[model samples]
Target: METKKLLKAAAGAMIVAFAISACQTKKTATGQNADPAHNSMNSVDWAGTYQGTLPCADCPGIRYTITLKDDDTYVLKTRYLEKGDSVFTESGTFAWDENGGKITLADRGEKFQVGENKLFHLDMEGNRITGSLAEHYVLTKMTDQITDRYWKLIEVGGQAVADGSTQKEPYIQLNSEGNRVEATGGCNGMGGTYELKEPNRISFSQLIGTLMACENMEVENGLKRALESADSYHVQGDTLQLFRARMAPLAKFVAKGK
Candidate 1:
């Protein structure tokens, strides 16, 4: 009877030891105590500013600035010169890839590819995105103040200038208050009265201005003709770029400083 009891006790101890060893082995293999949110691909953080120059022959080279946000949204800013005048700002929204490797822009309601790195291509998935790593470009995430200061271009349609020589000298000048804009000829500056129709559009009706001659009356005449031909104006940054449907390139101007 004593031998049997000792044998039973030894068997129980062996079983318990084997069970503990098996649990430790399982824990070692699975890392059960490790962090639940940890990921292996959090190496690249693409939440910042990326800037570059875009090539254009007819106008000054376009300056590009893109800002990314922590929530994965983005904005793009472009500056370019046109017909001896310069436009300083043009902007739109942006999107990013899962691993933070690529970015895209909402170019006229479509998601367009926009990262400097070619490793990952910016592609859209319905409303989501997928892409690879970027190189040679900086991605700066957006902040409150940054968003507040963002400049957007207000697109006004194009117009046709009158047929007289005086009508060809259309020039615009900002009022001392900056609230009103007056132009000379094209026809008359008084005919052009500015109306802030919508948040993104500036309308000019009955545009009129005084008739004057400058050093280069011919060039001034051409400028006036261009301005008179403008059916709409877009104000971006500290500059405005004018567009005409039939014209190949756009016109640009700097905003009057306060």
Candidate 2:
């Protein structure tokens, strides 16, 4: 009986040991953990495109454009400038490093140093870069701010322009450098500056228009009032809607892109 009990106890011990070892990280020939088991997903709030001209060994340059998505997926587009306009794209899931300062591409044995609005390419061994062209390895983040260009008025408070109206087309363009706007009030051409007082609030300033007397004065005056009263602005697709405080949009414009 004692021999049987001892044998049973030994088997149980061996089973538990095997289970524990299975739960541990995978080991390589050198007995080191090969797979990074650290889940550093919460390391950075990075999600956007990073683009730069990376130095190449054989080719003239590699135009690298990498976009990181919110779902932890990434799309890498590489363009060989010297080779041709041909672009090679690769996409896969990525994980953050144990130190939370880097990201490792699971599919391609590659890594990158994540920084504020930038990324630094790393080597195969996941080590520091030591090269004369290391400075050019950095990629800059793309801006999300509204482009500084003219947007023609497409609508006003849910009203689109009537067909065959003798009144001229209305428009508004914000100055990129300053808080200024150049616009046309139905018939008269005008220009003014704008001030952003809040995260979603804006106000027009010193709006002056051509003093031409015309039959379309009604349409022009209405547009002028809307601009002066606008307290906020929202952009959707190619359309821009300027709004008054606590009310619907006072004016709307669409970008006539080049």
Scored by CA lDDT, what does every candidate get?
Answer: 0.44, 0.73
Per-residue CA lDDT of model 1 for 1-258, tens digit only, reads 999999999999999999999998888555454333432224434455555554457765655555555665655555664544232343555654343333455664434333332122223442323233233222233221111221221222232333343433444554312235554433333334443322233444554446654342443444445545655555544665654553542444444322
Q: Quote the RMSD, in angstroms, for model 2.
A: 13.5
Give the residue spans of candidate 2 off by over 4 A. Answer: 1-147, 163-167
In model 2, the Cα lDDT at residue 131 comes to 78
Give lDDT tens digits, candidate 2, residues 12-60: 9999999878765344422355334432245445776788898888988
Tell me each candidate's RMSD, in Å, in order: 16.6, 13.5
